[model samples]
Target: FEEINDELIYKKDFDIDTIKYAILSKLNPKYLGLSPEVIILEL
Candidate 1:
């Protein structure tokens, strides 16, 4: 993949862990096998 023009989309000024936890909590039970830490790392 080639790099396209990058843009600042959404901006967050909150804590990283709090944001990750919030996202993880909203996930479906089927995704329980995926570690929340892994998800954050892959983000």
Candidate 2:
């Protein structure tokens, strides 16, 4: 996201929890007007 410079990663594993958290972080924030595009910076 260019607007806020959003960043995320999965260091060891790409499990459900990691994906869930990433989605929630982007979608559940109140300040943001719309859901941010989820990004995986590294694996």
Candidate 3:
């Protein structure tokens, strides 16, 4: 995240893989897992 001219923006350098892994963990309650339903909203 970055603040520019009083507005916040998602940094292009942000690691997308990290976001995917986070979503995967949330969907997998039993243990570490991966799913095809992972959705990343880039802004």
C-alpha RMSD for every candidate: 7.3, 11.2, 4.0
Span of ten consecutive residues with least summed lDDT in model 3: 28-37
Tens-place lDDT digits, model 3, residues 1-43 = 8799999998667577887777776774666444465667658
**Which 10 consecutive residues of model 1 have the lowest summed lDDT?**
34-43
Per-residue lDDT of 1-31 in model 2, one digit per residue for the tens? 2234465543554586678576776664775
TM for every model, in the order presented, reads: 0.41, 0.33, 0.40
- Model 1 root mean square deviation, Cα atoms: 7.3
Q: What are the per-residue Cα lDDT tens digits for candidate 1 across 1-43?
A: 2334774455456688877778877978686775546345535
TM-score of 2: 0.33
- Residue 25 CA displacement from its true place in model 2, Å: 0.2
Task: Rank all candidate structures by their TM-score, best first, as comma-separated numbers.
Answer: 1, 3, 2
lDDT of each: 0.65, 0.59, 0.69
- What lDDT score goes with residue 36 in model 3? 61
Q: Can you give the lDDT of residue 31 in candidate 3?
A: 63
What lDDT score is found at residue 7 in candidate 1?
48
